[model samples]
Target: MRLIEKVWFRGHPAKWLLVPLLLPLTLLFYFISALRRALFTVGLKKSVTLTAPVIVVGNIGIGGNGKTPMVIYLVELTRQLGFKPGVISRGYGGNAPHYPYLLKEDTSANIAGDEPVLIHQRCQVPVAVGSNRIASAQLLIEQGCNVIISDDGLQHYRLARALELIVVDAKRLFGNGFLLPAGPLREGRWRLNKSDLVIFNGSPNTELWPRKLTTPNAIMQLTAKVVCNIKTGERITLSTFVQNNPQVNAIAGIGDPQRFFDTLSAQQLCLNNTQSFVDHHAFCLDDFSHFNDNIPLLMTEKDAVKCYGFSQAHWWYLPVDTRFSAIEQQKITELLITKLAV
Candidate 1:
């Protein structure tokens, strides 16, 4: 294993030795995070209220918990309710330096980030990415978007939100359950209590402390859907793919590659080989040399942004859409309307 991976699994002796010295800094981070939250609660720190309702979909964990899919699903739901929805993101891994730049069709992934671009393309809504989500939300409002959906801004206390939706990776709820350098949690699991709704991307797990989002008239259920290729822009049912092909190459460059692989397996699609890369990895021509011309290459839509200029013909991207029950959709819609009324 690589040195970093080794240290991640087993703490380095040096890391332990520095723990005594790092203790103060770690405490400082915790205090700051807590202070920000307290300020929001006490109204000391002002949260910018948009003219429209703002629904935030985010996670306390450091990595992905199906936030993008949930955001897309919410966008569709809001549209069905006759509301024009706009999206705002921090553009986590983008080169755009502007505070609030409106995303256009020509916006590159490097500038607007892969998620924003994917959301814009799929949802067909106004999208903006910036360092300050509040500023981006304002820009979307100026564009006449009555409902703003934040892609991932749970910990971003600056942006005032009407409704907050927390997504958990049901499969890997909380890795190690420690905070920051200690583990993967960006905030305590108890923070889920503050969210308007808690969504489990995989399976429902209520054994954890705060329990499920089972408040008076809350919604809970597993939302599942199959993946498909984006090259032809058509949905390829998992059942059809599995019945025809026994072995396939699976490529994923998301926060959790294993989740995608496991989902494919659940559909009975046998993966002969798998390649996992860092989240938002850019694929170039050299990266495609591993596969023969005849072999099929499948990847997530996020990875397809970087592969657009490539000449490879076998490469395809699987586009997955989220599905929610009618009751869940109604609850979200009502919450949004309530927030907007304020």
Candidate 2:
């Protein structure tokens, strides 16, 4: 799968021969996506609404755009404003009973998906996952949640929302700007104009649309908060880890492993070995066999979901926190208060 992504992004020669067939398939997908959105817009299909406002954080492109951290940020922001925020997810890769189930640390990623489990662990708030987000939202509300944050529901139009936040990878913005099979977009770049807000995960870029959330919105920036040892449960600054490190092994099973790798490098930590796993990969004993206790193993918190039972003393996890500019934070607070009022 990694090879396929590399080849596709690199414009491998094999893609040219397949383009004849892929072009038609891509067009079909685009049309179907557009038609679905059209149905909801025209009132032909009903979208489920909640008593409280639903703020959806999602992307048109496939893979991660720092949605977990963004969700955590929103949760904290709403909590500060005295609103109880709950989270709902599709549990994309999980195999739960398909009914809305509340999340716990012990909940397997196989049942709640890695992202939802990570959110549940970090936010310490109500979290539910199922195929039907509307049902999940209802469950959270019944549990006394006043605000619902749907993770990665931008394209899930069946779930009505009061605010929409489109998270984009500043580094990989709309890869080639073509629809699926041709490129990475599930929706076209023009569709972004409809979003209530646009968030660039990394540094801001001028090539794409300017960063702003509509309907009393503001621009937020992200930065690493802290890194900790998964096995020892000790906090370590990226600077200290890099400076005092013996040989180290870096492992990342997130949407963009390179970004995490780059962060480590910025602190002068040159990984003696690096392993990239598919996003949300279930870590097993064998996955860590390559490195012995002599070498420290570092990973992201999302990857830590599947690695909770790991007893290896050398393992560490970095917890990153996202912070918005002062003005942006104020705007988000005001928006949530306004929604609660409504």
lDDT by candidate, in order shown: 0.75, 0.80
Candidate 1: regions farther than 4 A off = 1-25, 210-236
* Cα lDDT, model 2, residue 104: 70
- Model 1, 133-244: lDDT tens digits are 8889889989999999999888988777888889887766776555665556788777887788788776555575545545323333323343455445456665666666
lDDT of 1 at 191: 80
Regions of candidate 2 where Cα sits further than 4 Å from its true position: 209-220, 340-342
- Displacement of residue 319 (Cα, Å) in model 1 is 1.5
What TM-score should be assigned to candidate 2? 0.92
* TM-score to true structure, per model: 0.87, 0.92
Clashes by residue pair, model 2: 196-214, 197-213
Best by lDDT: 2
lDDT of 2 at 319: 85
Candidate 2 has its poorest 10 consecutive residues by lDDT at 210-219
